[model samples]
Target: MFSATVLWLLLAPAAVSAAPLTALTDCLTSSAVPQLLTTNSKYALAIKPFNLRLPFTPAAVAQPTTVAQVQAAIACGVAQNFTVTPKSGGHSYASHGLGGENGHLMVDMKYWTNVTVDSSTQIATIGVGSRLGNVAQALYSQGGRAISHGTCPGVGIGGHVAGGGYGYISHTQGLAMDNLVGAQMVLANGTVATLSATENPDLFWAIRGAGASFGIITYYKFQTFAAPNSNIVYSYNIQFTAANYLALQNYANTTMPAEMNMRMFITSGGLQLEGIYYGSQSAFQAAISPILSQVGNPYGSTSTMGWIQGLSNYAYMSLTTPIDYDIFSKSLMTVAVTPAAAAAFVAYYQNTARTVSRDWYLIIDLHGGPTSAISKVPMDSTSYAHRNALFKYEFYDRVDSGSYPSTGFSFLNGWVASLVNARKKRGQKADGCKVPTTTFGMYINYADSSLTADQAHNSYWLTHYARLSAIKKSVDPNQVFSNPQAINSK
Candidate 1:
């Protein structure tokens, strides 16, 4: 049996002699390890994080083309005692995929993308490096199938599915992780393991939610759903003043159908309630008639298009330009947005938009309906603990990199925190349409850098934290895979 000290000595680079650093660099550069990118390489920036807030620079980035190469990278990192972080889509808000801090070994998974679909089973085996768009295109083209994933097309399947991905159709099909049937992972000890409900069940559950901490995921097998017939999706964008925000919330809480996803965006311009319905136009109108009747003369429009086309229309990559921006993000899962909370957010957003040059936005995703199978699975069944949340709220603010003054960044961070705090004060907890209990929880995928380890653990896993920690200890006793908010073995 390995003692804790021995495990640290085996896994921690600091515990190893200084000579290994030179050897580690040599080994990485040799033909033995293929597609490795060092700091001085042009592709080094390819490993650069999607989120620029934390400019974390890893010592070297390895772009492994095969599972064997992934194993080799891990083995090298373990032997050299350097921290190794796996980068898939490089979309980590805290930049954990880029070593979180710096001087660690980064295994870039971009070159590993490969998608294969089994038509009879309707299961798609997607490489961890594959982006959401790649998966969608492959599944739709090959099998006419789809799985619930995030809105961002560029998001890597590695972290997205592992962190409990949710998106426009999630209310109907459940989250991306929920659809997971199996996965391939490289454990901390440089061992490749296959995980599923029956195979390595504990590690399977851990990776479904807290994947980054346990191992480097290589591929995911998902139970895909047949695409909706007609491939037609109807969307309505209703523009309203802040005064009407509460009315929209009430409508969403009571009248919205599970098949239709409603996302409310509070922006500098005003409040915009966007609804995407999966069925025909008539069904969409009938389902949303209650809300429409309440709001008089609101500016809005409805359109229908193919499923893939709709995905392209709503793709985050197409909507937002590629520019490095310093950003701060936070999230909350609440029963419903109370009138007071809505009013508070409106006032703060108005003030900030008017006063600062920074761009900020608030998006609320309505959860719960017959389509939301999230409650069908018990909270403890997986590491995703927010199975009972009624809505997911995200607050994001950004300024051009290096443009914000010292005080400017602090102000933006404070504003995002205040929005969540305000909701907590006024919000009531409901267990997936059950009676009110306490305040709501938070989503793990939108990891907040401002949160301490304890705070993040509490927010993401809640009651499941103990079980997740036990699994972390079982799989990664040395804490080889860790970050500010990574699950701790202790």
Candidate 2:
């Protein structure tokens, strides 16, 4: 077999390192290095934070084009007894992607951002580093769009799919991981492998929702759907009293026609309902009429736009909307957790936000259409378990820390507390969802990074925990992949 190092020497001579260095320059030798990174080239190569920045630094960063180079980098780490962390977009909040101070190397996957549309199968083979914006544009050009994360566009496909990505189309399309058909990964042992439903079924099942603990995903084959004809109607519904709760939920639970996607949220303002549909203005009116009637309130705006253009509408005001579609595609930057103190967290953040501003909101999206059905394969067959939820709930705070740290802090606390209180009042256990085990569950991607091992197992595929555990032991027995969000390898 051809050696990975030999292959790397031929493809990227710069990545051919003999001795280590204190900084990235001591190792890199490629011309492509300039093309693959941002201004703080060396700083960008370090994995300083994982929940909190650790005292570690990568010896260097390698931006590889092919999986062979990824394999080579891993092999080098293995040979040098150094840890390797693969990052396409540095969007992780947890330290999962952090390589620490003693780290051997940080394998940058940005150069692998390639997307190919397979009209024959209605599938798109996306490079793991590819951002959502490019994927949307590519699919739009092909006359189709996908169900993916809503706001942050720069989120890399690898982490997004690994965590069961949710987006505006979630109500209709289901989580991002559910749409995956195949994956190419570099194992901890330095093997470049392909896993899919029909191929390495076991690995495929493990990677769908719990991919970070498994391996570095180089590419993903995702199922796509027909592009919508109408523009996204961006609506912000504000209500101050909790009286509108049941009214909003009831309307959302019943009025969601498969043709129209609905997202319902209980915010500090009161109750909010949002959605996007696949039809003419008249049809869109028919779908949301019940919601409009139930709430009896005014809204933000309704405009028609391209599928990608609609995505741009939802960009959070805090982050600059990327002028280049591809730049914004790399969403999922900081993966910070809400403080561990749950009750104090709720009391301070939740109530404070409501008292301070009537605009605090919980966002939801209705997406996924005919192509969004759960696979006939058993629940254990894939990593993603939430295949039935029609809407995805996203709660966020827009307070600026430099100008208003207190407000920002309060907003986060309040936002988290509202979710906790709502779930508790509904009789949900700290570990489980109020929804039944048989039907409803949490989206792995949206799961708070602060969640405990038991909380993750209970909220997701509770029954399959033992199986997933066994798979983790078999593949990563030493727990070399250990991180706060990792599966406990007991």
Candidate 3:
């Protein structure tokens, strides 16, 4: 389970929001789609966020069955000067689908799911409400095709691709956004337009990363590939030493091939290495020999499976089922981890594993090799930065009940600090957490709601932040769509 930095548990929507605006109600009602007010019987469930730790009541929820209805919802929001938000699978880590903070008009996209494959090109067009699993199944069933995206079955495509999806196939095929060719969306001003390199190119560029900040993408088209017929999946466990960690990290950066992708989950016992290799078992063994040498040959399980079966191995839940937990998470994307930083991280984790109060785990995803599709892409080609990132660290923890512990916040945050601050500035006045440059930043998908706007902007996009800000101003001058961490127009 995970949670927001601030907790507003079990608070009724009506208690948190002002009296409903009749103008806004009538506007959405007149559009002929179902609407829910704060007082509605289903309003609480409608506004309930994926992360149970943070529950916020939006001003209203507009269920739009048609694209035109979505436009009307936006129009109503603009007319009332209320913030606009779109909920797709309601899986935003920061609960941005519930307007991040509160009182925004939420447009629920449950009715928008429609998946189809082009007979000629095999490119798949997925609606906003379609989850990653549904999309994958649709493409494969239609034409044995697929796209590179994260392993989560229920992650909504709306945010996943836009935020730069990383998954089993990412090292070879590139991110979900990298394969994306076009989309159809409603602008903040309620203009329903198409996005591609040729049409609405600027908005297209912004959509790849900062999509939610600019508009509600109703449908996304991804350039698909032939789903691999068979794959070798493996899992191994070992108590890795500092040198072993560095050796594996180095292998990930400079030697890992595009045909394979692996990640380590830090358990209290040790590191559990699990991944899917797109190639044959012989090739997989040859590829993994270096890590075996580094870690002294820890034996693990390996097997062959079909494409969809491999996906099922990684799938956790259904598209619509809500997992109840007070979930909290943070992420770091680094260009490189120095030797000192790696050692400090392993040491910190070793100690913290025994004392953590809640159920927590650290997932380290490998990225960047000479032939890596993700790394080969030019950094400036899209708003989704971090093409240079060599590794991604996702820190997740959850409590069964009650507000997230005060101690929980610092635990993961401290672990992240342990790595970044390992390499201190040369001329610091005294010992402090402040460092000249943090070796690691953050990922938008595993969003940290704790940071302020400035910190969020820099951490998510780095140099790409300025350009996104400019596009945000140009496309959404009125700021119709917004959340706490959204790129606000100045």
Best by lDDT: 3
Candidate 2 per-residue C-alpha lDDT over 146-198 given as tens digits, one digit per residue, 9 for 90 to 100: 55554577666777878767666655555677778889888878777789877
Q: What is the lDDT of candidate 1?
A: 0.73
> What ranking of all candidate models by lDDT puts the best one first?
3, 1, 2
The TM-score of candidate 3 is: 0.93
In terms of lDDT, model 2 sits at 0.56
lDDT of 3 by residue, 45-131 (tens): 677677776677777789888878888899888988899998887877789888887688889887768989997988888898888
- After TM-score superposition, what is the CA distance of residue 55 in candidate 1 from its true location, in Å? 1.4
lDDT of 1 by residue, 1-490 (tens): 6533233223323322446556776777663676554434565356555665566656666778887788888888887778888889888887878767767778888877888889789888999988888788888888688888888787888999888998878877788999999999999887889999999999999887888888899999999988765433433455544456666656555666667777777666656667467888788878777776676645577777767777776674662233345677777776566676666666766666556656877787776543456655676888888777777878777764343245655554555455566766554355434322224567778878777887888888777888999888888888778887889822
Q: Number of the top candidate by TM-score?
A: 3
User: Which is better, 1 or 2, measured by lDDT?
Assistant: 1
- The better-scoring model by TM-score among 1 and 3 is 3
What's the C-alpha lDDT at position 128 in model 1?
91
Clashes of each: 1, 39, 8
**Counting only residues 3 or more apart in sequence or on different chains, how many pairs clash (N, Cα, C under 3 Å) in candidate 1?**
1
Q: How many Å off is the CA of 439 in candidate 1?
A: 3.8
CA shift of 404, model 1, Å: 4.1
